[model samples]
Target: MNRDLREFRRLERLCLEQAALSTMDLARTGLLKVADDCRAAAEAIEARSPPRGAFAGAVQALKRAPLAWRVGARS
Candidate 1:
């Protein structure tokens, strides 16, 4: 997963550079296609990974915590 992310980042950067230098429509379109492909690949990877963030962590912890402990907690 890490390696795939790195590769996608690299390809995305390369495509951006090529797109900038491209003077013709066909070349720019090709670079845009490559960039879109990299974006899709990255999205696919992220979808398979568990959610991240404080809310997600709290939800996960709540799921793992005992029901008695959860109900007994005071605010």
Candidate 2:
């Protein structure tokens, strides 16, 4: 990837990290709005820079499993 794309990827990684933390909090609170916001964060990252190869499946898994359960291999 180009320099600009690499920078964008870095930003997206930050977004995903924040989203993960938010999701954990939302899950504990059981608040739909907060959970939705976290989900939106994930969507925004996907929009700007979709996951590559093995990570593509990981992103999909996050849609189903709880954030805490997203461990092990990339996929």
Candidate 3:
């Protein structure tokens, strides 16, 4: 992975970790938003780069994942 992509992925991971530890719903939501932004940056970088191996397929699957899960939708 390139420097920018790697950094974005790292930030995403950190944000997710923080969200997991968050006690307040609002804080967790904000952290998740940051994580999503980092993921978007990584995706943009990937979109511009040529597809590689299994990683490329994983990225495609993530894109197809349900929006409800990402947004934590509740009934």
Candidate 4:
């Protein structure tokens, strides 16, 4: 799960660098928050869908966050 999260985060960063994703997009599409939401998301995602497990977990949790980290990110 941790490895999956790391890869997810890497891809998220990649998107940010490319300016293709906003903070909301990161929280939604990448399904992640590196600093605070990581652990809870990992566990919840694993519990709900063990088949995709880590990947799905990350995406699920990412969908739930407020995305307060980047205000006006799309602008």
Compared with the true structure, all predictions reach lDDT values of: 0.79, 0.55, 0.86, 0.52
Tens digit of lDDT per residue, candidate 3, span 1-75? 699999999999999999999999999999999999999889778767766779887876676476437557744
Candidate 1 C-alpha error for residue 60, in Å: 14
What's the lDDT for residue 17 in model 4?
A: 54
Candidate 3 regions exceeding 4 Å error are 52-75
- Candidate 4 lDDT, 32-68, residue by residue in tens: 3442255444545444555466777677567545343
Q: lDDT by residue for model 2 over 1-75, one digit each (tens)?
A: 345545555565555556666648655354444545555555455546655667886776675465445434436
Question: What are the clashing pairs of model 4?
Answer: 45-57
How far is 4's C-alpha from truth in model 4 (Å)? 0.2
lDDT (C-alpha) at residue 18 in model 1: 95
**Largest TM-score belongs to which candidate?**
3
Q: List the residue pairs that clash in candidate 2.
A: none
Task: Give Cα distance to truth, residue 38, candidate 4, Å.
Answer: 13
- Weakest lDDT window of 10 consecutive positions for candidate 3: 66-75
Angstrom error at residue 1, model 3: 7.8
* TM-score of every candidate relative to the true structure: 0.65, 0.29, 0.67, 0.30
Candidate 2 lDDT for residue 2? 48
